[model samples]
Target: MSRHLRLALVQASAQSFEDFAQGLRSLMKSPNAAELVIYPELHLCSLGAETMSEREYYTAYAEPLDGPRGMALAGLARELGIWLIPGTVLERGADGAVHNTAVVYNPQGELVADYRKIFTWRPYEPMCPGRRFVVFDMPGTGRVGLSICYDAWYPEVTRHLAWMGAELVVNLVQTSTSGRAQEIPLNQANAIVNQIWVASVNGAAPTAQGHSLLVDPEGGIRVAAGMEDTTLLGVIDFDRVAATRKFGTSGDSWPWDQFRADDSPLELPLYNGHIDPATWRPAISPETRNDLRPAGPVVFCRPAGENGPQ
Candidate 1:
């Protein structure tokens, strides 16, 4: 049987945490409010300075997983009778390292998943990386996966969730004002290749791009919001995911049922079936290919024992 989820993406433009909270309360009262509500990334960081460097900003605002901010969000979930993904906040771990963490709350207001983001856009982000990937089943919704902002650039994250049976991948983002071109396309491509619905919510201007979007399994833009302060709502159909994977006769499929017995678990059937095992060798080279030329001017480093560059 196919499943459907009604979702709302709140594209925020609030300049302060208090303003964000106030606006959120009003949005919930909309006649179109959905069963699942999601907000853009780092909405809580509004209380801090916009001029602060990434390091300064994150460190100052970091809070514990069950801190006041989290409690407030969880309470809202229960009060509204909705499953909530209130985007991410800075989590100050027991070891004192700050992580970009997203928390999931079921309708009962129980924390279902506390996912610290696995990939931080480093050299620029200055946040600690997470070690775990989180996927959980919602009561009426199919399995749900969580990722935040930069994590959407890495297909492996989404693929891991899909493999774990997630029909929907939710990415809460604070898009770079200068990088929206790349950000939008990468997420759309990820949804197409993985054949899963993606709810990509983004922070609003005058600091970040606010093109919060909902993508269907076929990579269609079901709903998209401009760089404005508004909520975008859409319905996600799990039936589309099932339809995408259906292939061949006897109910065999592309992804959901592709990892059949007698197939090499590590390799997809498309590639494994085309190769002759007896004659195969690893296709990868042990070292970088000498034929490839560096795109920029190169500087040569000599071996310790050698007098000149090799």
Candidate 2:
């Protein structure tokens, strides 16, 4: 059996934490078929730590996967009976290190997954990468995985998600203006290679650009909204994901399933598969292969590829 998921990507202003909460609560009240709702990265603040000290943002907005923001989102997801990816927040780990993290909540309001930004998009210095990657069952569909604003740039994340049986790759983003040409193709290529759906919700209005998009199986932009606030509802078919098998036999086959598991439990399967010349083309890698600053997800993730400062 396959599931068709209705995803709602929230793109609105972040006047304050209270404003964000109120907006989310009100939006969730609307009647829709959305099984899961994703908020933009750092949607809790307009300019996170820009004016306030990093210490202040950590104290005020940073919370554990068990803290206030996580708890509140948990209750909301349970109350509304919808899965929720509340996006990323700066969390202060016990070791005094800060991490940009995301939480996944089931409809029962139970926290099912927690993904720290494996590829942090920091301005001052590099933040430590999270330990690993993980994928979990998304109710009726195959699986769902988390990648934050910058983490989505890596093909490894989406490929790992698909290899782990994720039918949909959900990205919560807070993209600034003028980085579209780079990241758009990265997202589409990730979807096409891994054979799944990718829905990214971005911030809009007040300061940044809002570009919430839904990409389908054929690597086509099924629905898209520009740098303006608007919610789109799209169909994510599990069957499409299941049909992406490359080998001649579909049942007992996966193109990259045989990838050796690594000790980095968070490691996503890296693909070296040859592209089908008849139907596919290679993605531009000049930008993605280098340590480019926040150009897009792929380019953004190159820093991680080097595993050091740029």
TM-score of 2: 0.75
Per-candidate clashes come to 0, 4
| lDDT at position 128, candidate 1 | 89
Count steric clashes of candidate 1: 0
Residue 73, model 1: Cα distance from true site in angstroms: 1.6
Clashing pairs in 1: none
- Angstrom error of the Cα, residue 251, model 1: value is 14
- The candidate that wins on TM-score is 1
lDDT (Cα, tens digit) per residue for candidate 1, span 170-231: 99898756777677777787787777788899987776788888887767888998887788
Q: Please give the distance, in angstroms, between residue 182's alpha carbon in candidate 1 and its true position after superposition.
A: 1.6
lDDT of 2 by residue, 157-239 (tens): 87655544455777877777566546777788777767678888788864557767888766789988777777777777766
